[model samples]
Target: MERIEIENLAVQIRAARLEDAGIITRHRYPGEMGEHLAVYEDWLPTVFIGGVYLGWLAQSDGRVIGGAGLLLINWQPSRTDPHPLRGRVVNVFVEPDFRGRGVARSLMQTALAEARRLGLSTLNLGTSEQGRPLYASLGFQAAATEMWLKIKTEHGLSGDSPASNRIP
Candidate 1:
């Protein structure tokens, strides 16, 4: 197979718009149920409300190749600390054809720059097995042991089923 020239691909990191919600959602979690789109659409407005930053579209001759972004995540106010400094690197995705090139690295660099610009003290992400190496090379260290427990609901859950364990 011919290689996609790294120099030919131009990544443009910009703020995500409402119209790009579908693409962003699908890119974030490929193979997810169609109904999940609603969840992202609902959150898009709020996510970008206080001006969440988003990276988008690695373009080559006007064809979009990949995208990534950093979101401004805020922890809930509590008695101990009213405000906390935290952020999340999310929606990081690259087109299959663009893999092996520097597209993802470029996107991540942009995201980190944005995080620093936003004055966030820490940034977090949950990565799949395939993504761990890439993240590790970028200086991200595995800190805590994350655990999850799922309980199946009766009547066979459908695409429209609501997620019960949502955080406030």
Candidate 2:
């Protein structure tokens, strides 16, 4: 991994690999401070293995301090571009000790570069209140309408194949 100095802090930023999946998963905080929450259930390298997801890791002193992921979403063709390529930046995190030192900024820059290289027409991300300022400064606009659906295994979802008894 090549090292880059940020704000006088020597940091190494490298492409994330399959072996780093656990590191990325473990580093995720998933919510506000003191939330004690994580996205453990979805912490799999399948996406990374599938090649649609590209990620980067920021390391210092032989340990990973931060990371970011870019996921390419396949959507229906639009009018302007029959096959519009869209990328979503996710899992942007920096260790508490490494915050405010440009680690996240560097990672975000790297992700953007990769997105451009991949010919992505649009990039999107959902930011927490704390990260809003940074993202806004980087030119990410707010989405006017966003909707989500969470499938609860105990209720709408079932432990076996989403209640369909078969995996889709």
Candidate 3:
């Protein structure tokens, strides 16, 4: 893709179809990440057909420049949301050359709009440090209450003991 200023580029956003699975997968994993990760392409069609996963693509001159997806995940109803389903924004990526051209922002906005149309009040996403500002600008606050721990049962354990690494 040619390096073009945002104003000079005319990007079009479109709904993703099941056939775009390959395109979306490339954008989502991109390069070596796909090789190291476990990706199940077979299940992608079901997500689209089932209407549980919504995706959008950004294109310029008929070439895809970016894409994003929202997974409608089932969760136990909580006091604040009282709903069994919520939205999880995923795979927001823009080509290196297309960075800073508002492609990612456009894709996200479309996903959010779809979520709203489906009456989803709560949304979540995991982002890199670089994506923090854009998400923040879009009113995504730091979910400070959330934490993660990756367990490796096959490898047993390594590094500091879990007890020794306690927050306290």
| Clash counts for the predictions, in order | 0, 0, 0
Clashes of 3: 0
TM-score of every candidate relative to the true structure: 0.74, 0.79, 0.81
The models' CA-based lDDT, in order, is 0.67, 0.75, 0.78
lDDT of 1 at 106: 73
Report the poorest 10 consecutive residues by lDDT, candidate 3.
159-168
How far does residue 30 in candidate 3 sit from its true spot (Å)?
1.3
TM-score of 3: 0.81
TM-score of 2: 0.79
Q: Which digits, one per residue and each the tens of the lDDT, describe model 3 over residues 1-168?
A: 223336688888888899888887876667734322334355679899999888888889898889899999997788899888999998899999989868788788888888888888999987777688999999998776877675667744234432443321
lDDT of candidate 3 at residue 167, scale 0 to 100:
24
Best by lDDT: 3
* Number of the candidate with higher TM-score, 1 or 2: 2
Q: Tens digit of lDDT per residue, candidate 2, span 1-168?
A: 667998888999999988877667655543333312234325446687788788899999888899998988896567765656688887898888889988988899899988878777678886766678878888999877876555555434322322342221
Candidate 1 Cα misplacement greater than 4 A, ranges: 1-5, 76-83, 145-168
Q: Can you tell me which runs of candidate 3 are displaced by over 4 Å?
A: 1-6, 33-38, 153-168
